[model samples]
Target: MAHTQKLEMLERDDYLRFRLPEALKERFKLYCYLKGITMSDTVREMIEEVLKNEDLEKLLQEKLLQEKQRENSRDETDD
Candidate 1:
């Protein structure tokens, strides 16, 4: 016969805070409501997934390159 023991986990009281545009916040709130999911869990899952990615650096570099290209296009349009 084998015996098994359950492990207890500690409660998480930490918070991650950031700012976003009001319109974006409202959209995210509505999306969560429609999906019947809490905002915290959605954000936590996204964070965990990002942390687990092995190609995060390449992903970040691609994002930065895209942003820079957008900025350049905007500058050209503004000229």
Candidate 2:
């Protein structure tokens, strides 16, 4: 088995802390353990996924607009 290095502790100025309900915290801890990832990493991945989805949505909208413009141009040329 490969040895794991200890994660660096967060400094007071380097991180923000939030309180979760006790029940939620317990559930989150269990979920994190089952997934074999730190809670922080799970949260970070979730946030990244959300941001990526938003960017994808914007790109899809732009492509749809371009397709509409092309169709309009074709219609004008045919008329």
Candidate 3:
């Protein structure tokens, strides 16, 4: 007799849930299945990639400074 792989049904207690549109969720599920990957692995890799994006951080900081400058200008106008 050959050995069979047992399917694991227990969810990870440490896992987090993210909400997505139904169509997009289905597409992502199928994509991961075809790529022989779990959703967790794909999301983890994407998170790591975004966290490593220095340009994104710089852009966000620039936007934050612009917002603060605008707020200061508004306060000056009101004074």
* Top candidate by TM-score: 3
The candidate with the higher TM-score, 2 or 3, is: 3
| Model 1 agreement with the true structure over 1-79: per-residue lDDT tens digits | 2233222224434887899999999999999999999999999889889789768889899999999999999999999
Off by over 4 Å in 1: 1-11, 55-79
Give Cα-based local distance difference scores for all models.
0.87, 0.83, 0.85
Global lDDT of model 3: 0.85
RMSD of each: 9.1, 10.7, 9.5
Please estimate how well model 1 matches the true structure, expressed as its whole-model Cα lDDT.
0.87
Clashing pairs in 2: none
Tell me the lDDT of model 1 at 66.
100
Q: In model 2, where do residues sit more than 4 Å from their true spots?
A: 1-14, 55-79
Candidate 3 lDDT over residue span 4-66, tens digit each: 322233433366787899999999999999999999899989988988876887899999999
Cα shift from native, residue 52, model 1 (Å): 0.8
lDDT of 3 at 54: 61
Where does candidate 3 have its weakest 10-residue lDDT segment?
1-10
